[model samples]
Target chain A: MISRLKEKGAGDLLKCIQCGSCTSSCIVNAVNEYFNPRRIIGSIVKFNRLPDQDPWLCSSCSICVERCPQRVNPLSVIMALRMIKYENGDAPPSRVFELIEQIKKTGLAFPLSNEAYEKRRSLGLPELEMDEESLKEVKKILSEAGF
Target chain B: MSMTLYLGCLIRTLYPEVEKAVYEVLGRIGVVFEEPKGASCCAPLGLFSLSKNAWLRLNERNMRLFQSTVLTVCDDCFASLSDAFKILSEKNNVRVPEVKPFGKFMLEKLEEKGLRFSFKGLRCAVQHSCHLLRPARNVDNAENPMVVKNVLEKLGYIPVSYVSELDCCGGLVFEEKMRDAIARRKAEALEKSGADCVVTTCSHCMRQLKSVSRLPVLHLAQLSALSMGANPEEIGISEILLRRMVNP
Candidate 1:
């Protein structure tokens, strides 16, 4: 019931009837039991504490959302839950954290460490460039946005 | 115009051939690139895993470093960049990084920073990245998607309709148990659809679909490069079938 949850399109949690149709149709649960959409909804309906790690199991595939007769976007609910977990520092994996750190340091993700760039250049590909001045402009825009 | 090419993890490690093809194609289209040092994982994996704050902060740092228009040949990177821009702009109230779902981000970014570039239209099938189209809800139509098709048509490619246009390729769930079934379903849809070629934004989907389909799956950049007259072997899709349609 967090205000941000409302902003993220999670207003339909009340409309869910617990019929298990979403559970049956969810591909995530078909492979991984931890990804039960019904259980997550049950917790929300009962006002019980939402499980900390359960929401992270979602791949954001939207299969459940497509199948739900009630129009309840279970993925959005999971996303809202994840936001709470993120703020509380209960994140899922270290690789996720490492990746974010890399992006923060380098403009692109997946460090070009594998020498893929050189291989590309050997194929007669041109070297890409964005000088410091342009980067400064982008930073200026992001800074203005409170980033 | 010269720009930095951003190749994500999957392309670098799993599909270096794709990287090669994209480079050749872009070069043919008169697009030049400089690969920056130390770029790594756009953190879409983290975002997919629901690490929002981590995803946000990391992408924020990327936004800070990039001053030039960013050009990416990978749909995963493109989707991640677009989604990150949307998320950060929403939270921080700043300008959304002018990025196209395909090759537009780098071009638009250049324009924003006072550079000039012209785009010739491309004929292709736009494989929408799941995160951008499904999660971010940035795509206009969920059932019958058109963002990528519209972009290509505007750029000059005859956008062809395909059956797997809106189907999932099981990219995110590749590690899951149902991956084969999921991939099969996506492959069937794409094969049944009659696109001249399958052009996608996500590298993961490209890889997944490529594994299952006989039809050629080209990255949007490769298609652009091909249309601009890059040789097929140089584009790395010469061996792939170019049949008009897959048997249903």
Candidate 2:
């Protein structure tokens, strides 16, 4: 896992001195004390494995990145961890699949609703439409990415 | 130069008022823009985290539509789109357009047109999205970190200083229980600031903050639209919004 993370661009994992500043400054930690960034870093550096749900708990705001004295960029490390998980056939929550499915179908995160159409029409702004070709291309990209 | 507007999923589906307000306000300031097709979600936090390639190619495909600038109200989208572009362009040699968020982009145009408006002394708590302010390199150069605060002040409004004003709204994490707690905690701090309305730039933050706070939430475009000659009622802003919320 250490070699994989290094290859996956989380080489900053080596730079961490485990100062615990990240866990202290983390906003998520303020609410759930168990969601400690320090523990994640320590565990990942030591065992190269993340505790259950640790990486996903991060909001990816990069506050820890800005606060890290070692410039470790823990958020990127978390992201790399997530990608590693997915590559190993571990899936995220169901909503992530739903989002990709929505994008595949509508080329959007959500389906455009009637109220939106009414709002746009009422405003007299020209309707914005995604052509079929564009939708096809979007699907192609998602498919190529193995979504 | 005119901008090519990229209405991501949230703005197009949820907050058309923000869309309308931004379009009308930009028109009022003499900037030409087009609502382009072929745009999709920037795969935000969850999607990006789970699959970086999907996030990269989807955004790159979307970027294939425009050159120079793609204007948006979603800072998360701007952050994701720009980061994807930087990664793809550097690694895979793919090209992508630039993303300009609402606050800094609006301030630039207002400066160019020499258009200034006052806020009539309304006090607002500006919610800064983490994506906009952090990982700062590769951002759209929104100028100072206080771009929205400066714009509010220029429009004659006061920004209330409060603890945790710069904290994330915690919208990125997918854990439902922890997500709600984070949102509620941040909202409590914001409400305690005693600001009139919670003002923010990102549509995602507006929704998340509004769900958790009793205070009225608004996009910076909504507040500035009222000041930029768009009718408050026409753009879905209450006519009493400013007068009722002004700081004592």
Candidate 3:
């Protein structure tokens, strides 16, 4: 677990000293009693398992990281946890995979649908345009990165 | 002198009006902004947490897609592209084009144009989105962005200070459970500031602020246009915000 977390991005999470600053700054914990950052850190440190899908609930806003005294980067801890989940054959939501596919296919988040085209035209903005070379390069990078 | 506008997926997909305002205001202020067509999502949400390597590579691709200065209307894109620039330069030893938020870009250009804010008595608290000011190396003024405050002050609006003004709006999490909590904090900021409305430089913040705060929220571009005496109808700001514009 330590090796996996280190490989992802939250290697510094081992520096966590049970400080509750992350909990105090966590927007999720502020709302839900079940979502506790301190407890999750303890679980990862003491045990080898991610508590649950709780890490996926993190907003990736990095507020806790901002407020963390040790600069332990609880946000990365969450991300590392999610990466572990993905590696264990637990795929992320299909919507996320769909977005990844969209980028590879069209070099866009979503196609400039007719509604958007009309909106841009109404605003006198030009239509979406991209060079073929950039698209091919993006595909190459994603393919090489094994994304 | 000119920059390619990097309208990320959020603004293009969900908030095209904000994109419209960005173009109109930037154009009005003498900015030669062009839409970069091939730039995809600035490493779309969850991509970074999914794979940091992929996120940086994707954002680098998007950043390199445009050869000129890149201006972003979405705070997430600003952070993502800025992160790409930082990683590519510092970590990977590669250089890419400049990616700046529309607020900072406009602040510089507006100062050059010597434009003054026309409205004199409006009060607004700016929502500083997390991504706009995170990761330390993404921007020079990540600690506290003065762009929005300066624009409001020049426009004759009060830049209010409220509790947790710098807190995250929790928009990045995509968690429905935190909506009420996010709304409460926004209400606290608005109530403390005693402002007529909230303003933000990020499209995501603008959307979240609107959902949470009872007061109307303005994108800096919309506010800039309104302050410069542009018609609200043409800029595509909501009627609620248009109503709050004093002496427009």
Candidate 4:
């Protein structure tokens, strides 16, 4: 699991000193105590165990990334954990899935509504049209990424 | 004096007004910019959790379109593109263009002068987007970012100090109740500060703050355009905000 996390770009997570700075600065932890970065990293560093908590709860604000004295980017570790869980059949939230599907089809996560299109036209902004080639390329990348 | 503007999905889709503001402000400041044709999304943070390779590849595709410099209004897009640029440059020797966030880019341009401001005395609260300052690489003082505040100050607006100024807006949180709870907390802090309006660099922070805050929220570009005498209507400045924020 540690090796996988390193492969997923969280190589420095082992440097976590359990200083709790990450948890102290965590915005999500302030609102919800269950999402503790220190505890999560401690478990991973000590036992090489994946966190029992939902890694998606991390808002990716990266305050933890800034406050970590050991230079362990807790946000990246959390993201790495999320990728491992997701690739192993754990589903992300439905809204997240919907965003992926939207990107797959339109090459955009937030496609404009008709009202929005009218608004854009009224604003005199140029129409943002994605060419077929770009869309095909994006879809190819998404599939290759296992989305 | 010129750059390519990458309008991330949020500003391009949900809040086209911000796009207008970007155009108005950049034009007023003599910074010529063009939106890249067939530009895709910036590959949102969720994509990183799925596959970092895909995220980098997609962002690299977008990065290839811009020749010299790329300016982004959304902090998420700014962070992702900056990260991809760093990693790809180190690994594959890709020649990624410089990525500048809207606030920092505007600060640099407006500091050069020639633009005039028509509004003053409006108390504003600035939300420095987390991604722009964090992982401690994008900026030096991530703990107390003043990029947005400095830009507002340059334009004659009073950036009021407030508690929870450094708190996250929880814009990326997947849970609704938690997201709103965090936004609400920030809203209360802003309200207590007696700020007439909120100014932010990121569209995600703007969207999240607007959802819960009673005070008017404006992207830094929108506020700058209005201050520099752009037509309020054309820049999508609401009559209420214009009266409260500009005329006050």
Top candidate on TM-score is 4
Output the better candidate (1/4) by lDDT.
4
- Tens digits of lDDT, candidate 3, B80-134: 7876787788976766778788777766777877877666467888888778776
For each candidate, the DockQ is 0.20, 0.70, 0.51, 0.83
List, residue by residue over B1-248, the lDDT tens digit for candidate 1: 66666777667654556776666555544566666543445666555445455556556766765655566666567767777877788988987545544445423433454432233332355566665555435445655666666545544456777654665676665244456667776666666665556777678778777888766777766654544456656556554332321210
| Model 2 clash tally, residue pairs | 3
Per-residue lDDT tens digits for candidate 4, residues B40-64, read 8887787777878888889878877
Interface RMSD of each: 5.6, 2.0, 2.6, 1.1
Better of 1 and 3 by DockQ: 3
Q: Report the C-alpha lDDT of model 1 over A52-101, residue by residue, as the tens digit.
A: 34565565667577667788878778877866666676845465555444
For TM-score, candidate 1 versus 3, the one ahead is 3
For model 2, residues A1-147, the per-residue Cα lDDT tens digits are: 767776666747778899988888888998888888778778878776665655777888788888888999888778788788888778777877888898889878877788878887888866656789998988888888777
Clash counts per candidate, in order, are: 25, 3, 3, 0
Local error of candidate 1 at B116, Å? 21
Which clashing pairs does model 3 show?
A59-B173, A129-B37, B117-B155
Once model 4 is optimally superposed onto the true structure by TM-score, how far is the C-alpha of residue A11 displaced, in angstroms? Answer: 3.2
Compute the TM-score of each model's chain A versus the native chain A and list the values.
0.77, 0.89, 0.87, 0.92
- Measured by lDDT, the strongest candidate is 4
Segments of candidate 2 deviating more than 4 angstroms: B92-96, B138-144, B239-242, B245-248
Q: For model 2, name the residue pairs that clash.
A: B118-B155, B119-B155, B119-B156
